[model samples]
Target: MVRIKRWLLAALVMSAGVSGFMLTKGTSHAATTDPQTFISTLKSPVTTVANQYKLYPSVMMAQAALESAWGTSTLTTTANNYFGIKGSYNGASVTMKTAEYDSNGQLYYTNANFRKYPSAKASMTDNAKLLRNGTSYNTSIYSGTWRENAATYADAANALTGTYATAPTYGSSLISIIKQYGLNTLLDASASDSSSSNSNSGSTPKPKPVVYSKATYYGASGTQTARLSGQYATYRLYNHVKGTRANITKTAWSKVAAGKNVLVYLDMRGVKKDASTGKKTTWYRIRFAKNTSAKKYWVYTKALTLPTVKYTSGTAAVKVNNTVSGSYYDHVFNSPYLAKSMGALNKLTAKSYVADKQAIKTQDGYKSTWYRIKVGKQAYWIAATETAAAPQYDAVTYSAASGTKKLSAKYSKYTLYNHVKKTHFNQKTYKWPAGSKKGTKVTVNFKGVKTAYKTTWYRIQFNGSQTNYWVDARALA
Candidate 1:
């Protein structure tokens, strides 16, 4: 049976897994074992993630070191995926052919997806999340690794031997590394009292019991989602730190976006005074993917408020109607009449939602069609002109058929389409393959079935070109 954690995710120089462990770069073995440098470099980031996620810093740091080969592993260097966590982040991923044992316990080679992260800290945060959330099948499978649940980091380390990895020695390996580097030996550097800390080696205090914060900033002014109006880096606020700008790094989320959605974390907002200019910059903290991790980033207000919502809606039921991308709202609106949001859909994992109903709404003379999108247990609305009528495709396979077929003379050239997107593959240039001129025979392979139209599609090599352009039965007439 397939391991629940091994479910393919989005990756890297090294492929992660279809089973347990995938392929890596030219060097399968770890290139370096510099534990000191690795621990030093990752200490701050691991501490932050552990503190936020309620994981043991020592266990997490040890896992990172062992999995990423002390930060010299191919996957770590190329993809920053220290935990061998496979899956995409924000539609980003890398692929590699990995050697692994399938559920049948037979070794095989296959390409697998691993999540790509922006920073090492980001990967650490994601890894911590996996432990906290566990696999979809078992939410409490890794609960033994929680700082609250585990009496010590050693207990947490042992919990991963079979569950986190295929090796029986995985836990001992981590323990050795931790002991060698004195990773878990420290109570916590933050509690610096010379009297108690310097008193004795065996006398260090245990960590204070964790208190879940009940503070909700929402009741202040409430939250809203908005896209960055323009490209400007965000910074974190450190009230306890002496200097304003020096407290936190300036680049929180640097990727620029015009319509990129952000979950506004607070409505009261914040203002940071520039050291040089004395001008206070208004900042709004937000999460890029609201439904995923709860990690937050800050963005200046102007870049977000600049893009005005301009969407065209259509009437009649449509398949995978393009997601309602809103400029001002945090997500698709809950209703055309209300200003509430439904959260943003991730680009890679977001299957097109069906808009089954449409209504006309006029706000301050801005008239548009409001498409009601049904997702899961609830439905939401997006106001704009509708252009979602044509059918798209579902699961496709590459077996079954391959050969040549003659097109009908009715269409000298037919517009090529992206079967999955339900949009023209090429807007201007590609119509029918030049070799597929009216009634001409063209090479076809990889049969696909699109449901709504109940049609068949074939991957055709156009004009001896390698690109796999798609053509449905309509071209065959």
Candidate 2:
């Protein structure tokens, strides 16, 4: 089942092409050279999605690039579904579908559940939300620093449980795309950096344009083309960061459009200088925003610290189980538990409960209890809720007294009602036996011929004790 699920998930990602793979150095350059037309049409909407959802712009862009090959996939073309999202949308969705597999090793075609949009931009915007909130894949990998132990986006993609085998190199492929285009540059690390700042009273530095295209300078404004504007005391642009000079005299807007999507380098107070290079720098990296209004630029407050290298020697058999202290139930209650009835529990004398096909003695005394029980190397109990009792079999106010019939000793009669499965039927409302009470409402929907069966009859199911049991099921139909 696990293997089949993994394959299905891989198919969804790979079928979409680029989005399935991780961004790494090997595949980045090849995948990133998507057409400019695709970029222009999709880029703006992608940025809008990032800003609205507070997600990293580059990650969104990278996923789109990977999924659609810059709007080239059949899924995207027909359904506007760049992510190959499954079909069965509760609201508006595309009718397009593709063949996939289930965990049972059966193949089926399902309409990919996708939110259809008027344009590729709208699709990009919706895709961001799906990525951030979707349960199938984890969005953490795209947002934060990758951790060693926890599963990230790449791991989640691989862990997916549907047809995803088409994209064999999905994780590595996406990573390659990110590195090639420097797409990870869209995340803002400024907030994390600011946490370590020594200055409490200083104002946060406004960002310098990272990719300014044109500029205007006049009257009271000072301009520098290649470097920092003279208006500010100190300003420096890092990699992927751009600066533009603009004039306030003519009331003209800054000419540096900077390619619409830009990563800005903001100022950080209390930055120190490298004595040898005479360069004033802080631990800063460039992050792109989806649009002009986006909270685009990010500057780190702390200096970049590199971790010390480590080395590992040979051979050792380490203990895999790290269970320090906990009861057996705590370890495996949610997983590997089986459903067993109280009658089956008592009859088992083996090391644990035997698998299906093993016959056991039936005890009428303990029938009300059904347990999600594990009886193997270790026996554990779960889902131990008591089963409800049968309804009363006596005269009632709302009686269906049409054609009453007698039943065989093993046969039970039941009336068809919405709450017939309920254990305690109201004796005042429905016809039932005189001695019946709340504890006798247990009856499985018996499969048999309707004409031969009684419309309503008494069914006695097990309770913990004999006296507590009562006649249950509907009176008559």
- Compare the candidates by lDDT and give the number of the best one: 1
- In angstroms, give how far residue 287 of model 1 lies from its true place: 53
User: TM-score, each model?
Assistant: 0.36, 0.30
Give model 1 RMSD, 1 decimal. Answer: 23.6
Q: Whole-model Cα lDDT per candidate?
A: 0.54, 0.34
For candidate 1, give the lDDT of residue 196. 54
Q: Report the C-alpha lDDT of model 2 over 1-477, residue by residue, as the tens digit.
A: 011112223224334334422322321221223444444455566666664665545555666666665655555555565555554333656554556677555988765444444455556655555544544443332222121211233333332212232344555665665566655443323322342363475554333222223322111101100112223112222332221211101111132223222323222122334322344533332223333333322122221221121122211111111122212221112111111222332333333221111111112222222122244454333222221111122232223222222323332343323222222222112333454444333343222122333433332332332221223333312
| Regions of candidate 1 where Cα sits further than 4 Å from its true position | 1-33, 186-477
Clashes of each: 21, 56
What C-alpha RMSD separates each model from the true structure? 23.6, 27.6
Q: Please, what are the lDDT tens digits per residue for candidate 1 over residues 113-232? A: 777677878888888888888888756557667766565777778777556764657779888977877877552333223225566774645544322212112112133344444343
Error of 1 at 101 (Å): 1.2
